[model samples]
Target: MNASRRDLLKLGTLAAAGSFLPAAALANAGSGVIEKAAKPLRILILGGTGFTGPFQVNYALARGHKVTLFNRGKRPSPEWPGEVEQLHGDRNTGDLKSLEGREWDVCIDNPTSLPFWVRDAGKVLAGKVGHYLFISTISVYADGSKPGMTEDAKLAEYKGKDAMAETMETLRADIENLYGALKALSEAEAHKQFGDQVTIVRPGYIVGPRDETDRFTYWPKRIAQGGEVLVPGDGLDPVQIIDGRDLGEWMIRLAEKGTRGTFNAVGPDYELTMDSMLHGCHAVTGGKVTFTHFPVADIPEDVGLPIWVPREGTPFSGYGAVSNAKAIAEGLTFRPLATTVTELLTWYRALPAERQAEVRAGIPLDKEAELLKAFHAKQGA
Candidate 1:
């Protein structure tokens, strides 16, 4: 049940900010309470059942905002703390008819990869909503080799024949190249449709509860098992991750304040290294473990390692170094890494036994042992 090589690469590339850790933010990490807005506002979320959607819904409800979700209604609804109206529609077939003539104070578009979704939504909710917020990714940037890349860096260009004609299936057919380009196009389309009132928040490596990818979760779960763990690099490479709740809550705050412009929503408020990240997870789990380090070149290409992208010589090396100062300036905050680990484990454990048995991501034990044996033999020789 080991994760595929593609999965590892996708997680490493697709998934930072800030230096000062907020005490109040840490205190409220596990709570359902937040500062209420000056006045209640109507909020519309395009997708509500995915990883970050639920957090946004829960936090918006906690802040006393009226919330509405528009989706296909395939997944069961979460036990929301307050009343939330659900509108059923599919963005694939251009079926946003349910959203026609609806008005809200703000609209948060999640789970949008195709540009046509934005175009179609604009057809319905154009002037009806006061503000539009789009959830984007750090991957939209063209270059990740330069450290400290900001929101103004060059964006990837869609090399395909026509951006508007691309679909999920076409993007999946060539994800590595198309995903970033298409997302960049989607951002432009958002600004085009929503005008200057649009807010673009690009986050990297969003890890927390309800995460089906298990990229960041793999480290905590593997380290908790207590044994020789395979770690990539010398442990000095920078690493940046934002909790789902932190990102979700900040988006709501931006909507409340009508914050505009693009921001790199990456973080711990300070710099973190791979060594520090793993040790932090172990500190919380109290797992008896030893980490064995290997150079990136020593590892087999097919054996995928999650959340350990090389700090040098790769296009995505800057992923761990992307700036989040813009987000921090806009009241963006992060929970401690330990808090994320604890809550993630709690959520994973509470899942059904059958679900827990499936290995979501990481190197299999047998493969790890084999790699370790070969590595040690080379060292001895």
Candidate 2:
């Protein structure tokens, strides 16, 4: 089936499962809150066609908020229900001329990778927009720490060049490490431009349907094969992730509520360990699985290791445990972890066989089992 038909079929299937929401239900829960205002809030999202962007767009549209997207017009979205105003421009060239004189209630910055880009965008929208929401990463926290870390923790300081060439070189070398520092610097720039109006949402690994990146996709595919699972650590290492839909909802809620400050937008603080996370996936997929843990040192030098290994001496240090109390207190609640896993599995199964196989490559069940066994054995020895 073609992409369009496939999307329709997926939507139909999800709708039957009660996972999909009608546009009306997506509207504000009640008029007493931010929704009660006479005028529908206008929102501008930079990079609304990418993986996480579409979810935000769908959410805002469902809530009856008017949305305008600013992008280079290179990556067009498939058909969407509501009419979204598109502003064509490239952040690289700093050409946001199309957005001049247009003010919005909120602006979600999704595409900026560099501090300069954020700085320029903020300069343009500073006084024009009410709330400037920066979709930041959990990576901004110092490395290796997990659970209980709050948003005010020490941020990674990035002094590297913000231009394309320098940024690309650093990114190509180590994406995970570089991403946090870069994001921290970018957030700092945004704060400098728009202090109280800026809200930073630092989300942990976000996973859901239509995710182009295969980081979270590996687990579901692995479990579907029904075999021993390869676990990075003792399966005790903390893990946290937020569904894209939930993230989108909370972001919109934050805007509507006029919440400020740095919020760690993640899943529940409890039940955030590697074992529980994988077990959740296993239960949803109904796959027979056992975990084999590897010590940090014995991770084989291979092309396709699923786990992230930190450099020696840097072992899980900064922002290890993040606290979401602030967001929770501000009306951020996640669906059960089991629900997220189940939906993720459903989405995975809905993909065409060809696409499924492409992502499933380099993740054979036996190899995973073998690696897990080696790692576990080393730990025992």
Candidate 3:
């Protein structure tokens, strides 16, 4: 059955209640509500104009916190409600002078892709910020993790100081392991500088509105076109995504509650499978999508798939599923997958017609049709 936005909102509300309620009341109310604490927080967010930064900005604003943004002032955005201060600086050359004398309750580091950059920033803002939150990725784990790996499992080690030099190019050519290692090193540096004041949020694929890159948008856009859809691999591989807004909310909550430690900020620990993810997209778009599941052996040698592709012998082996119990226990909850997909589609539709064409041109229609046919055939089988 197709899931509606209303249904997804209801699910999110219920999940929030269950996730935020106290343990004693959880049994009777099935709600997750923690005691409210009042300490108006002032936050500074690095990389506030990026894909995930805006959501974080919105979330903090909603919670009645003051926010200061540090960026290069390249991409200007709509003015935010409430008090928002923007500082101009570049982290590459260590020109964070604008933030020299400032102090905030918490600082969310969203753009520290390199260890040196993180180390420099941490050195500058160490004692000034109360809590330093570094947004890391799930890629920090070993290449092939056990089914559901927790935070303390096999972590990637830093190769060297110049490890993140070729991040952009390497990330595209399937060298995310190095990227993760550098980020892991960066997180370690932040903790080293601030100790117990650091909170590391390692998230899976993050999807939501105002997404400049259409990585996750491709699925919803293709499904909304209403035809056969492509199924990579068995269509049973587990897929997890944390909505940008949910990640933002949880980050603010952590700052408010002074939560610490490395938490896996993912979705509900429920029966989520690859097929269910695709199905959720189909339901949200109200499109009839037939999946054509391609066997590992039958995948065309030259067919370039941009997303996850597992190595041989391990169907779910390449990217291991992350456990969110730690984050949930610390008051992390997810906005339903259905809601995320719908909002993603809505944002895509709101784009200019020319921009939409530009995005769709990335994928060849014939290849998409073939994949959809394969996915549908697999569904029937």
Candidate 4:
């Protein structure tokens, strides 16, 4: 099963209403660190109201870069720190009339899942922008069972009849089979249009504030509740993730330096295991949380546990171990694990009470309890 299949189910769900991080936390998010460019660059972001785009906008403004956002004007946008030009267009229907004759120093394609989105934008953006940056996923790898895979790893191929003709409706009809392959094709299409000026960033499990998916947020919130925690696997499975803020900020820096190449935008600059991740998040909470280990087999096939994948007999077993050495060598950095956990919980706590009651990802408490009981009984027998 695809690791991100669960997340796609929550697609089109807008950011939770009343989602706001504490002002102090926002101030501290990128404190003591600044990557200002030598000269201001005109930066254009395709989709700037989503999880990571706001971070990019804020950081770019702080670094004295002029920023512009192009997206369907359906969602609410945050208050930008500096002036930002907003243009509206629908890429799904191939309506990119708004971008004609516009030029920018760099273009960041944040939400291109369909190859046609790239094809349509390329018609308007080719040679208009100095650089093209496409945000792709780590799922593009054809064989994810191998540990330490790099950007050169074989990518999944589009098995569809016509990749350029595939639409959002068609993609949703078979997202599990097409999402990765389509993204891989989109990367190729971007290269075909922009050549050496294209930058492909492949990231896994982007978790932090303003993320409504709650894939990684489930852990911090569950641990904060102060009770028995049912942990899948022996807690030895390697895990890789990048805070969205780190990713967004780094992309701006990449645009500033004109860094061009494919890089795995994963985190920590070191090896991180599920054991370390859980305990690291737990450290930020004052609640008493005791964890009980359970076999990966105990997890029901229908149940999707966020961010924990067993190494034995599992597809994408090496998903958590993909190499980020190339990205690190190019100035990729990570915030403290505690910071990610704290800010996520802080942002989550600010959500409406009704929204707080909804757990977007991870096992339900009752189901988790039942599984834990079953695991204990088998051990006793």
- lDDT (Cα, 0-100) at 156 in candidate 1: 88
Cα-based lDDT for every prediction:
0.80, 0.64, 0.65, 0.82
lDDT of 3 by residue, 1-381 (tens): 111112111111111110111112111122234343376789999877665666667666656788899988877554554567999988877788998988898999886656777877877898999999988876677544455678887777765446536444553353434566676788888888888899999876666665545656777787788766656677666666667667776788898988889988767567566678778878888856677665655556555443333433542254426678888889887767777777666666766677777652124677666655665577789
Q: What is candidate 1's local distance difference test score?
A: 0.80
| Cα lDDT of model 1 by residue, 125-156, tens digit | 88989999998888888887778999999998
Score residue 98 of candidate 4 by CA lDDT.
89
* TM-score per candidate, chains pooled: 0.93, 0.80, 0.81, 0.94
> Candidate 2, residues 1-381: lDDT per residue as tens digits?
001111211111011111232322222222224333334689999877765666677767766889899988886453556888999998877788888888998999876667777877877888999999988876677643444678677877665554334444555465545666777788888888888788998876566665545556677667667766666655665555667667777887788777888888766657566677777777777857666665645555453433232222343422324577887888777767666666666666666677666742234656666766666576689
Task: State the TM-score for model 4.
Answer: 0.94
| lDDT of model 1 at position 270 | 91
For model 3, the stretches where C-alpha displacement exceeds 4 angstroms are 1-37, 160-177, 301-320, 360-363, 370-381
Which regions of candidate 2 deviate over 4 angstroms? 1-39, 161-170, 173-177, 293-297, 303-314, 317-320, 359-363, 372-381
In angstroms, the error of model 1 at 18 is 29
Clashes per candidate (backbone, < 3 Å): 10, 12, 18, 0
Predicted structure 4: lDDT: 0.82
How far residue 357's Cα lies from its native spot in candidate 2, in Å, is 1.6
The residue-by-residue lDDT of candidate 4 on 1-381, one tens digit each, is 323453432222222322365322453374676656799999999988878888888888889899999999887778776799999999988888989999999999998888889988999999999999999988888887778999999998889899989987887788778877988999999998888999999998788888787888888888888889988888888888888888888999899899999999877787898888989988899678899887776667777788776665665787778899999999998989998888788788887899889977888899988888888889999
